[model samples]
Structure formats: C-alpha cells, structure tokens
Target: MLQSSPKGSSSLSDNDNSSDLKSTMNDISSQTNENSDYSILPMDVIVDILSFLILSKQSINEYCNFLQSVHNKNHHSIFNLFFGYKHWDIHKTHVVFLYRNFIVKGDLTPYESRNPSEKVEQDGFIMNYIFKHAHTLTVDYCPMTDTYCQSLRKNKRIERFTFIGNRKHYHSGLCSALRECESLKKLKLDSVYDWEFTKLFELASLTYLKLNTGMMLRDFPPQKYNFDFIVDIEENQGSIKKILKNEFSESRLKHLSLISSEGFTDEYSVSNLMKLPALEILFLENQKITKQSMRTVGQSNLREICFERCLNFSDSGMEQLMKVKLPNLTKLKLSGCGFNTSNLKKVFEPSNGEILNQLTYIELSKNQNMKDTAFSKLGSFKFENLDTVDLNHCVSLSSIGILTFMRSFSECIRTLKLRECNLDETALVTILKSCSKLQRLDLEMNNISCTNIEICEITDLSNLHYLRIEKNNLTDIEWLIALPLSNLQLPRKISNYGTMQLDRQIP
Candidate 1:
C-alpha cells in the first residue's frame, strides 16, 4: 500500500492543481516494492483515471485507493479491457462519465432516446468501458441487457450498484444474476416497477439503501409512490412513514437516506423514521418532515444526521430533536434550512445542550435566518469535542455575534469555514487569537480586513496550513506575504494592475 504524505503542501491555483494531481498519479508507479512482481498498467488506463482528477475541486481522499490492485495480481484482469476511447470514436461520446452512483447529464435533449436499438447499443458500449478501472455499475435511462447483467453475474466484482428510473422487467434470470453479485452492499433506486422491490431488498448482502425522487416531484404530491418500498414526506400523516417502516423493517440496513423531490406534502405524519432498529445514519434531503416525524429521533442509534435544503424543518422541530437521547451522535449538518437566532440558541444554551459536546463535526451553513444573538447566546456553553464548524453563508452574522460564537469551541476547533459571512478585521484577528489548533481556514468571499493591508497579521495562526482568502477586499500583496503559508489562495483581482503586481512580486 502506498502511504500518502501530508496533503497540506499543494498549490491552490487550477493549473498547479492539474500538475499536482499528475504528480500524485505518477507516485503510484514508483511507490510499489521494486522486487515485487506486479502488472504494469498501460498509459491509457492511467489516463482514464487522470481525466477525472481535478486537484483544485477534489481532495486527496480520491487518490487513497490508487494502489488497490497492486497487492492482488488477479485484479490485473481490469487492464485486459481498454476503456473510454478503445474501439470508439468521438460520435459515440456524449457526456462526462465515471464510476459512481451519481452524475448530472449536461443536457437531456442531446442524449434523449433517438431509437431503442441505438440507445441500448450506446448503453452496452458504456457499460463495457465503465468497469475496467473500478466496478460500480449504474443503470440509468437505458435498458439492462442480458449481456451486461450476465457479465456482472460472472464477474461478481461489483460492490455498489445504482438503478435509476429503469423499467426493464427483472425476469427470473436477471434476478438470479443480480443475486450472484454477493459483493454488492450498497443500492440506490429512484424509480422501480411494482413488486420488484421485494425481490431486490431480499438480497441479504445489501446493508445500505436509499429511495429518492428528486427534480420531478409535483407540489404536495402523495408522499408514498405506488411502489411497495416508496417513502415520502408528511401528507395524509403517517401513511408514508408506515409504508416505509413496514417495507424495510425486516432488512439489515446500516445506513439509509431518503430524498424527496423539492416539495413538501401539506398533510402531517405522526411516526418517526427512528423506529428502524438497525439504522445508524439518517439523511433526508429536500423533504419537509413535521415535528412528529422526528419526535423519537433521540431513540435511534443514529451517529450522524443530515438535512439539506429541507425548508420549514422549523427551529422548534430542531430543538425537540436535539433535546432527546442523541448520546451517540458524532456529526450533524443542517443546511439551507431556515433556523432563526432564538430557536438556534436554545438547542445548545446549557443543560439541554450537553450531548452536543460529543459531536466532532457540525455545520449550520446556509441558515440565513441566524443572527448575532444565536452565537452570543451559545457562547455560554462549551462544545468540548467539536473539531469542525461551518458557519458559511450566514449573511445575517457579522463580527460581534461570530466572535461570541467562537468562544464555545475555539479551544478545540481544527477546521473552520466562514465563507460569505462578511467578517471584518477584528473578527479575523479574534479568530487567530483564539483558535490555536486550527489547521484549515476558509474565509473566502468576506469583507474581512479587506481594505487595510496593515495592522492585521495572521502569523499567530501557527498551525494553519490551508487558507482560502479568495474574494477579499485587501488593498495590496504585502498582506499575503507575512504568513507561514503552505497552500495560499490569492485574492480575486483581474485588472491589468493585478497582473503587473503578480509579475513584479514573482520576478
């Protein structure tokens, strides 16, 4: 196994990022033991992976598995099949591709089914190239032919599979072929025909499942789809929740995520998703659940809970959920949900807030309703184990309230994000003074000490190695020169004068 060095030393520009990723890929060829016999992959195979590596947009975690095939010589079968451009031309290429459960097509009109034969032929062509480097099969907008499923049964190398909106009949052969994939552990489904879900979930090897309907949900549509496994939000009360519980009750799932389309049912539901005995993480996206749906959140064994873009997930609902027995929770993220200061303050004001100290990462970004008063009130409490805090895009916040907010976790905080918060020099200075353990700081898109280049110095942030100061109001280059920086981002200024300044500084 190749060991990754500290990733804090890479440059921040896009061009530098490309070279850095290339260097990391080359490291794979050189890191293996010289005496060990291993298959040398052709250049095209390596380039297939490199095409997707955007160092500036991606993290070092993506490279951690580069050497997975080196130890097992048999895995060299991956190289036997050339991918992407092999035996194909530009006309067949339509969009970005990868091995994952999710991808957004650039535009549907271009790839819209021209004809059934052509579509299946294109899909089969795609499936052939997709698994040469990694085995994640995703069937979307294309029929699953016997050839591909038969290959899957024979190889049985696929560990994760995503089936979205594919209506092909799963005959006995197809089901048997899928069952042969004992390595499959994670499954994602957007749309499935009636009665097919029972056969799918019966796979004993599956430990993670997600049911989602994003982008096409009509307003106040029934929370329950016609399918037996459908799970939706409050409308006609607990009907959706009841169906969800009954459908998945017997499964041995460890992680579950429910994402409803961008609409909430006006009706209410009484039951909670926590009743699932084996669930460890619950992620809800774009669905509005009532307080009753989360009433027993404290009773679940969940260690992480995330709600993204779920409007009307009210502050009172959040307060009720936090007051329960969430002793095992280690991470919490609530973004794009409207939570105001008073209600936000109450979640961690004191006695009712002690369980929060156990969380290592917490993000309340995009909660535009939060103001200075929330953090000011929270300053009285201590978040002992919280290492990361994301207060990004909380425009209502200024330096005063944020300064007070930092007091609660400043001692233990390691990664802090204050992007788009419009902070000033005083608050930034206070952050440097207080957060001694900070390693990564993102203060992008802020007005922080933007105008004055003097009287503000961050040399005190001794442990800080990654800093994002892009889009600030700083006056000149001198302010950036004084720091013990490893990965530094230049302020956004695109004038001729800016170009000259860069030349002068470097030359």
Candidate 2:
C-alpha cells in the first residue's frame, strides 16, 4: 500500500494531470491496508476505470501492476513489458501497426483465402479480437477482398465509424456494414457516394453525422477551380443546397455546421436548411448570403445562429431580422460579416418599431465599415436579458454611439470586448461612467492614451476579473496601481506619444 502526498505531485513532471489519479489511488490503498483481510475491487471495475486512462497513458494497468509485483520482490520479464516509450512515436506505431480497428494493410499474403497451407490463425484472431470489442472503428482504403465487410459488420455496439476511401470502395463497404450496425449513432465519410441513403435511415439511434465533401475541389464543367482563392459565392451556394436538400432532413439533428474554405451561403440554401424541425444551432460561413437569408432563420426554432465572413448581410438584413418572431433565439454572431457606419442605423433602428428581447449575446467584429451611429443604435436596442456584447476592431467608432449603447445595458451585461476600436480617453471614461455591472472588459489595441487614469475610474465594476488592454499608446504605469481586479492584461508595448485628450465629459 502506498500513500500519496496531500498536495499530489507526480515524479513525471510532464504528466501533471495524472497527479489527481495517483492521489486518489493512494488514498484508496491507505484505507484498504494489505495486512487486513479485505476484498479487492472487481476486475470489471478496474477495466472500466482503466479504459478512460487508456487513451492518454499507454498500458497504465501494466505499470501499476508491475510496481505491485516488484514490491514483493518477484520481478520478471513480464515487468519489462510495462516500460512505456517516453515519446508518442512508439505509441502511434503500435496503434498503426498492431491495432486491427484502424484497418492498416500489413502482410496480407498469409491472410489470403487460397492459402490453405499458410498460417492465417494470428490474423483471424487479431481481426476477431478488434471487431468484437471496438466502439470506435476507422477503415481507410484497407483491401478486404477475401473477407467481405459482413464479417466485421456484426459489431452492433460500435458507436462511431470513419470511412476514407475512393467513391466505389467506400460506398459499397458502408452499404454492407450499415445492415448490421444497429448501435452506430455517428458516421463520418470524407468521400462522396451515390445516394444510398436507405442504409443511413435504418439506424434508429443515429443522432449525429458529419460528412465532408471537400475532396473534389472543383466547380461544374464550365468553371475551373480557382487558385489562391477565397470561397466562390456561386460554388458555395450549390454545395450548401446539396446538403440541405439531401442530408439535413434528420429530425434529431440539433447542431449543424458547414465550414468551407470561405464563409457564406446564399438565400435559397439557407431557407431550405431552416426547415429542420430539431435543428437548434446552425453555422454558415464564407457564402455571399444577403439579409434576406438571415430573415429566413427567424421562421425556424433555432436558438443560436453564426454567420462568418458573409459580406452581403448589410443593414437591410438587420431591418428584416427585427420583424421575425424568434422567441427561442438566444445567441447571434456576425463575425467578418462586414457592416459600415451608414448601415448601423438600419441594423439598430427599432425593427418594425419594436425591440428584440430574445437575443442574449451579440458579437459584431472585423467590420471596417462601422461608425459612431452603429454603436449608438446598439446602445439603444433595449435588450433586457443581454449579457455579452463584442464590438472589436471598428476603428472608426466614436464615443457617442458606445456610451449610448452602454446606457441601455448598464446593469445586465457581464462581458464586453471592444478591441482595436477607435476609443480614446473620452470613450473609455464614458463607458466606465455608464457600465457599472460588467464582469470582463477587453479594450485592447485601441487609440486610448490614458490607460491608468481610465482604469481608476472603472472601480464600480466589482465583479470584473478578466481585463485586457494590449498594444496601446497608454504608458502610465500607475493607472492600474489602485484598481482591485482578479485578472489584468497589460499592454505588450505601452507608448507615450499622445496627450490625454477628450472631446466630451460625463455631466
């Protein structure tokens, strides 16, 4: 029996996360003294616990059992097998070479069905051992000419399956294997297949599926594949429409994400995807969808929607969005969606002369077109339950709009990020004066010159912990001396070039 230190620390400095397990084992050992007549834990329990550690540590049971064997002075060659490689190469090699579940081709000469004289016992045994117990199985272009997929398809308990092969080989294997896999809930295939979807519909328990059709990187016959390229707006729309029409009709689908090299989906594809009854979250990136597509989302029961790099969703989209009755929607993200200062008025103006109360988090960043009016409309939106607002990298935004927005959510907002925004001393002072209930504030790479002075004024934010103000022209070291915060992110290089200038004060 071994007793670990109260502050558990492992000898293997790199394996710090294992300290908790070692400490728990030591505690159990100390309680169950070796001298006492105590019943040992069941073998099944040991195996179950060992399974979790299996992914991280190589043969952890062997190491602990070897230590036990050595403690009784009965060290043998079997104990030498407990020695693990210091690096990951041998572990990976073991998985690649020995693990039959990965389906790596080895010396198949002995496994040939015609070879009656050749020994096939070991290969059969290993394959049987793997297919009998493997929960997660991957087959990547491994030739199974002799034994059909039916031999390994009876593993009904397999929860995950990954297929990577040419169209003909992989689709046939999938169609064959799907008949026996009643327990498979997830399936990932990197290659495209002819629509053999009846096999997909058979699995009653299937809830999640991720299919990547990124292999054939070309458009239709007329259009050649563009190089040094962002996502083609036309090509992306077609791809999205294909998925929405064929694949996304699953009633159990809760989360759906389509990530192209670019970020955008057109209105038609977007409208079709919104028809999913159970889809709660949807992500569309790098497609040239306009505000009209954003309006289609309002008809669904979606709670979270993310639009990344969708350049055409301008102020008009925001106007249409305000009129949509989204009672369940909570989180909305518009990253790199590109909105200018003029469009801010249309976005933040009262939609149909009413406020949107369901949206809890709003993140609009990297839109170089943002102006003071944009922040002003955001400030006046009057969202009662809003908690987080991210307005980062709008360098043209002035204090008036931001201050007005903060006034609307002076109490509810918990996290606020306004990095690289054109906020000087005047803007920072206004935010501190108005926003009293913030928990985290990020004002990094801004045009602010008086960091220390502005920080001292923000003492009303009691729950504030995470603060970042990096790479700005604020050099006063004493600015943060009096503030009481749990966490503070200082500027990497504080510049002392500009004077502490302000246009207006809080009267």
lDDT of 2 by residue, 1-507 (tens): 112222222233325546565554444444433343212444443343333233333334334543455343332212222222122111222222111134443223333334453334434444444554456766666434334465557777777677666544454465556547878777766553433433454355666654444333333121111110211233564553222333334456566555444322356556555666676887766655677765544567878888777777765665566666666788888887777766566666555233346668988877777777765555345667889988888666666666767776766888888988767777766666566676677887877775435554555645665666666677664655455443433445545433222111112
List per-prediction Cα lDDT, in the order shown.
0.58, 0.54
TM-score for each model: 0.62, 0.61
Model 1 C-alpha lDDT per residue in residues 303-408, reported as the tens digit of each score: 8888787776767767877766766889998888788877777776776566788799988899888888875556568888999999999999888877887898
Report lDDT (Cα) of residue 284, candidate 2.
63
Tell how far residue 268 is off in model 2, in angstroms.
1.4
Name every residue pair that clashes in candidate 1.
Answer: 237-268, 237-269, 450-473, 450-474
For this target, which candidate reaches the highest lDDT against the unseen true structure?
1
TM-score of 1: 0.62
Query: For candidate 2, what is the lDDT?
Result: 0.54
